[model samples]
Target chain A: MIRHVAVFRFVPEFTTEHREHWMALVRALPDRIPQLRSMTVGADVLRGPASYELAIVADFDDLDGLEAYTRHPAHAEVLRISAPVKASLATVDFEIPDAS
Target chain B: MIRHVAVFRFVPEFTTEHREHWMALVRALPDRIPQLRSMTVGADVLRGPASYELAIVADFDDLDGLEAYTRHPAHAEVLRISAPVKASLATVDFEIPDAS
Candidate 1:
């Protein structure tokens, strides 16, 4: 499996309602994007100095599955909402070895 | 459960050996730190414009367990190895709702 992890810091002007709407869209992605094997989306509970505002961890069978999800219209919709309000974003894509 | 996710960008000077040694230590953390329920560490497969070089996703029973893992000597040891070589680090701690 491949894991895709993204952390986001929202712009200071992004309101509670905006966050709720964005998070809802992200949480609904697996249902809309068939390539997602599993996904978890959450708001950061600890607003520490190094903390980002939100995170999503999603799993795919392979890079092709991940690419499919990335190009899916549902994901683009979420990204459209995110792009304007995001202060910064960082992502990591990595392979997950099967259990020994 | 609480999920702690961290993304790191290593300094330009950090070499392959440094990464392997650091990864070995981090992969050994779950065994050394009993507070960790589960952990996954990986080097980034896609070095995209917004990519971070490494990422870790770990789960704990609660904030207390997370705190214990953060304060553990073994974790400190890993930090010592990571601190100087890490150009940037970002973290998010959030609640993972139980599956319905």
Candidate 2:
């Protein structure tokens, strides 16, 4: 499985409202798409320590599943909603060891 | 790779002193053990929103590597110090997608 960690930092001017909207969209993705093994996105409640305002963690069966999810129509809609407020984004992909 | 995410929560009275120790132990593991691939442990700077106090993220080649790290003398030492202040712990193992 591939783990994708995506963080979105936005202008604090719209922090609260933007966070709520982003999380809502993320929470809605798994229901709309398949191969989304697990999905979690939330605002960092801690004030200054967390540099990014929102984080989304999702697990896919493999890279193909992940790529498909990223290009899925539902995710595209989320991006559309996201474009207006995003200040910066950071992403990291890591591998998980296979038991076999 | 096997991703192990562990969250440790302690009595707030000792949070400051204890977190320093927990993170110190985690940060030290990579240098002490050969099996560790990656390790990160930090406190939740945002208050009230995050339930866990400290989260330790480590990725190992497989479960055997993970077990070796856990049973390794260095980790055992950390646990010995951790016992006095620990309140609760949560762990999850997930797979990362293989690009191949």
The superposed Cα distance between candidate 1 and the true structure at residue B32, in angstroms, equals 1.5
DockQ of each: 0.86, 0.05
Residue B58 error, candidate 2, Å: 0.4
Query: lDDT by residue for model 1 over A5-93, one digit each (tens)?
Result: 99999998998788888888888898999899888888899889889999999999999999999999999999898999898899999
Q: Please write out the lDDT profile of model 1 over residues B69-96, one tens digit for every residue.
A: 9899999999998898888888889888
The residue-by-residue lDDT of candidate 2 on B1-100, one tens digit each, is 6666655667667767766766678788999988988876656432333345666667778778888897999998888877677786545554443331
- Candidate 2 deviant stretches above 4 angstroms: A1-100
DockQ of 1: 0.86
Which candidate has the top score in DockQ? 1
Each candidate structure's TM-score, on Cα atoms with residue i matched to residue i, is 0.96, 0.51
